[model samples]
Target chain A: MARLAVDVMLKPEILDPQGQAIARKLPQMGFEGIAGVRQGKRFELVVEGPADEAAVERVRKIADTLLANPVIETYEVHVLSDN
Target chain B: MARLAVDVMLKPEILDPQGQAIARKLPQMGFEGIAGVRQGKRFELVVEGPADEAAVERVRKIADTLLANPVIETYEVHVLSDN
Candidate 1:
């Protein structure tokens, strides 16, 4: 079995309202010294076989087409385990 | 500056409807060979200072109390960069 982790984040130019809310709430909650916060999505996938180039490419396609919106978001794939 | 990443995932025992939907949709979308898919939240935080133990702890506290719902989710914190 193999595992792949995809991290999808808002583009640097995009505005993240959810993260802004957290930044505002943090200070109110007495947590200080945090300058910024950005919230995103993470997807963990378990593939039935080895996480080879083909498997990675497949996941990348999924990430690009389905998991993330290319206009406002970007994604990166990491192979966590391959065995 | 320092960077902290919090990954919040549904507990294994819990049912993830969103993930299930994606898993089912993947095959229909022409992506195959994936056995399971789990969706989660990833928070990227930028601290004004070093990402030491104290900073990590503060973020952990934030993650525990505000970022994640303790009932249905579990979270892990990773210090991405410290400078």
Candidate 2:
């Protein structure tokens, strides 16, 4: 089994109140010098398949289709450790 | 500054429609035998500070107070390699 991490982020042009809320709180959280905390959805999957190029493609398809809102968001996928 | 990865997930008892939807479709996407795609919010923070215990504590407070809903979600924080 392998773990996949997908981050779904809102498009730059889109307005995200949730992201805004999170960003605003960062400073208060003792990260006084930090900025730009874009909030996004994260998906961690335990896929039972060979860790191969084809597996990544399959995960990408899911990421592109149902996992993210293509109109208002962009997503990036990461393959974490395999077990 | 260090990158902090915070994964905010719904409580175990909470019915997560988004998570449910994602899991249902993952198998079709080449993860044919895998399941359990939990949907959560991710925050990548570039905090400017010494990577000290205090800094992590401060970030934790912020995560508990604003970034995550205490009643509905639980969050796990990870500090990535500093840049």
Candidate 3:
């Protein structure tokens, strides 16, 4: 089986309030020098095959159609190697 | 500036209903062979310096205390190169 990681993030143009909240709170918590922050979603999928180009493509399709909303968010898919 | 990516995930033993819901829906949507699915959070932090070890350590601390709940979730921090 192959494992794929899909990271779904809001587009750069979109405002991320959750990330803004964290960025604002960090300094108060004594963590300084952070310029900005963005929050997103991550998914791990175990598929019934090797982590090949075909598998990556399939996962990419899955990411596009189901995992992410194409209007405001984008996603990236990566293959995870067996350990 | 440097960018750091922090991934926060539920512990393996924890239940992920969102993931389960996705997994169940995928097959119904005609996507097959997905053995399992797990959902998590991803955060991108832009700091006012190079992505040095100190920055990674600082992000790790932030992730532990604020971004992730240590009881049921764990986090990984990675330094991202300027693009």
Model 3 stretches with alpha carbons more than 4 Å out: none
TM-score per model over all chains = 0.96, 0.73, 0.97
Ten-residue segment with the worst summed lDDT in candidate 2 chain A? A27-36
Superior by DockQ: candidate 2 or candidate 3: 3
Output the number of the lDDT-best candidate: 1
Worst 10 residues of 1 chain B by lDDT: B47-56
lDDT, candidate 1, A1-83, per-residue tens: 89999999999899999999999999888999999999999999999889999889989999988899999999889998999
Q: Cα lDDT of model 2 overall? A: 0.76
- Candidate 3: which docking quality band? high
- The collision pairs in model 2 are none
Worst 10 residues of 2 chain B by lDDT: B26-35
The candidates, ranked best first by lDDT, are: 1, 3, 2
Q: In candidate 2, which residue ranges exceed 4 Å CA deviation?
A: A11-15, A25-31, A70-72, B11-14, B25-31, B50-52, B70-72, B80-83
Which candidate order results from sorting by DockQ in descending order?
A: 3, 1, 2
Q: TM-score for model 1?
A: 0.96
- What lDDT tens digits, residue by residue, belong to model 2 across residues A1-83? 87887888888798878767777866665557665566788887777776567767777887887778899989887787776
When candidate 3 is compared with the true two-chain complex, its DockQ is 0.91
The DockQ of each candidate is 0.91, 0.57, 0.91
RMSD of each: 1.0, 3.3, 1.1
